[model samples]
Target: MTKTPPREALTLAAAMNARRLSKVFVADQLGVTPAAVSQWASGHRPVPPEKAVKLADVVGTEPHLISARYAELQTNESGNVVPIRQAADGADERRNDLVIARLENDVDSLRYALGALVTVMTVHRPAEGAAVAKAIRKHVPVKFVKQGYVAELLGVLDKAGHE
Candidate 1:
């Protein structure tokens, strides 16, 4: 019989820790029993591809990492072995900071766009339809506006203006 790879097991363990997800919760999310989750974690059984991806989602880890760890665990039966390589804590912190910065920038841009929409709709009520549309286009991408979120925002603005 083939052994579970170390990387695969470590990845699964790391994902659980990173996500703060319980083994029982992950199993429930995957529609499996907690015993199955434990088995996978213990490297006694291999996780199927589809279930592995679902497990990763529950664990908030990439599916690729879980797959790699599963392979590593197959090679080492000790179960205590580390299968995945983890970055230094400082490096992890830096990556999280970068993620937060990007999220903040996105929020700021969205807020600016919403403000522009409100400004154009309220103060410039007599403006031509094309001008209002142009202002919206300038603030938000055409593709992004297609999902009706822009319309919803405009509806709110209109209601707020009335009250």
Candidate 2:
């Protein structure tokens, strides 16, 4: 009589069997070298932290069992040793903050241009205002108009001499 082997030993092998999931295919899905997959499956090396979650999902197993060091790769971009959890959250926040700042500046510039356009259209050519606005609205959507960018839309009228 023989005991059943643990699931980890058979995981990648099973995936391979299930749908002809080849080593190259699995490596592509997991963003790893085929050699890395072979080493992990053979128990020569523990699965790396980044690949653990995806590999666990692929094999339908809990992540911690796949790799004991599931949370921390303990290496930084500059090669300094640090807990990934600590740096990861801060780096994500900084990226979000930078993106938000850039978007805000872009919207501000749009608003200033819109204000200038309104001054040109209504003050300069008040009579043909409706026609000029309609022509510009053909290009700019209603959302921008509601967001107070109607003036930029109407700025097109200035170029076309619609006024």
Candidate 3:
């Protein structure tokens, strides 16, 4: 009786097989050739970081799950030298922090512009000021409008409406 060797685990090929996806289909989704997919499937080449994320999306898994290189990049970016074999919650938190920081910056810019707009409308177009303020409040979060220039604008609009 002949015994087959144990199959390698934690491989891209395994992930694809579990999803029941063919190499040609995956290659088409990734805009790569079937030969390229074969190389990755056979573990002859590591998936490049640029392609890793897209490949993960194609396979319905996280990049680190399918690509050691992506996991290495995440581990290194976190300022740790320890090799990670899977995605960690800490990595997700770090990525979320980056997105939140960018959104906060954009909100700050919007606040400044909205403040200037309110001031202009109040001075030259008093009748339109309340409408504009209402529109702004409707679109912006309550917490945002409750502070800073937005707060001042709402206060002014309220007083104007009362008088």
Candidate 4:
């Protein structure tokens, strides 16, 4: 039995993900079983050079990147995989910042919409009430409305006292 080339194996996995190609599809295309594809992906069986070229074409990626990554994986087989902590941390921070910005924008927009709805509701009756109710009901889920029932009751009392 010949040892499978590491680069070929890694390239196969990367190509699978990058192309969004399934093992079943690849197997069918390659005239092989899904288990065989799985083995190749797991680095147990290296893809042959001819198959590697075909995979690169199918995956729409430069064959070199896949080959290089595979080589890197081969060199790092000392049982200690370097953790991509910094990249993960950076990704997490960026994700949090985006979530915060989105939340801030949503809050601002909701407040403005709520204020406008209140003003419209005050000026217009029956028709406007129905429209505003529809708008609110559209945006606010039944579960959320039910959860806020108590707060809503308090808000009604607060408004009554102020008026």
Ranking by lDDT: 3, 1, 2, 4
* Candidate 4 stretches greater than 4 Å from native: 1-91, 130-140, 147-163
How many pairs of residues collide in each model?
20, 0, 0, 0
What TM-score should be assigned to candidate 1?
A: 0.38
TM-score of model 3 vs. true structure: 0.42
Query: How would you encode candidate 2's per-residue C-alpha lDDT over 100-153 as one tens digit per residue?
Result: 776899989987876776667676776576676776667767787555446555
Give the runs in model 2 whose Cα sits over 4 Å from its true position: 1-89, 127-129, 143-163
Candidate lDDT scores, in order, read 0.64, 0.62, 0.72, 0.57
Alpha carbon lDDT at 54, candidate 3: 86
TM-score-better candidate, 1 vs 4: 1
What TM-score number comes out for model 4? 0.33
* Model with the higher TM-score, candidate 2 or 4: 2
CA displacement after TM-score superposition, residue 151 of candidate 3 (Å): 58
Using all chains and alpha carbons, the TM-scores for the candidates as numbered come to 0.38, 0.35, 0.42, 0.33
Candidate 4 lDDT, 19-79, residue by residue in tens: 7999998888877798878887877766543454455566665444444432233222254
Compared with the true structure, the alpha-carbon lDDT of candidate 2 equals: 0.62
